[model samples]
Target: MTEPATRVIVVTVFVIGALTGCSRRDRGQREVIQNKGSDTLVNVAQAWAEKYKEVDPTVAVAVTGGGSGTGISALL
Candidate 1:
């Protein structure tokens, strides 16, 4: 496949893995996954969050865009 398609596939797989890993917890309580990153990825992140909901309705994915620096700082 083309480079762009490959990149998309890789990212999709990574996101799915992350969401699934985070979802593995108490099913009785609602869980929220915070995804914060580049502004350019805001739309893509939101799309992933929406799709992930179908996979696990008990978990809510919250996405916010504030650039790479801000995203990294949040990890600290």
Candidate 2:
């Protein structure tokens, strides 16, 4: 409703949509996108991941949350 809330939703949607294209696969392996971060975003992220699976059944989106610290560590 608020401008900032709308912005966050838009950005989150864009990032998730972008990530669908970034999934990596190995020989004979299925595609997976690991989305981890922000406890505040956990519910929304999980919902998106589920919906995305419906759109593209070939790829799996794994969403996890443990705050930004955990996400940063996972990234490195």
Candidate 3:
């Protein structure tokens, strides 16, 4: 397959995996924002989460990073 096609497949798999994971979550009391992907973005995401928390204490933000594969598998 061509490179772009392969990338599209991978991204499609990732989005499907993410969506499936979302469906299984509980309807908890708190508002939650789940950000899981790319170890490289961990610090940046965390920083944003921290600031966001200060702005809105009622909402919850989760920032986790273990690598691209790890992030995707989290959706499983």
Candidate whose lDDT is highest: 2
- Candidate 1 lDDT tens digits, 15-55: 99988856555657788899987999999999999999999
| Clash number for candidate 1 | 0
Ranking by lDDT: 2, 1, 3
Query: The CA-based lDDT of model 2 is what?
Result: 0.93
* Tens-place lDDT digits, model 3, residues 27-68: 556778998988999999999999999999878999999899
TM match of model 3 to true structure: 0.55
TM-score of each candidate structure, all chains considered together: 0.63, 0.62, 0.55
Model 2, TM vs. native? 0.62
lDDT of 1 at 58: 82
Per-model C-alpha lDDT, please?
A: 0.91, 0.93, 0.90
Per-residue accuracy of model 2 over 1-76 as CA lDDT, tens digit each: 9999999999999999999978666767778899998999999999999999999998999999999998999999
Candidate that beats the other on TM-score, 2 or 3, i.e. the better one: 2
Q: Which residue pairs in candidate 2 collide?
A: none
Off by over 4 Å in 1: 1-27
Candidate 1 has what TM-score? 0.63
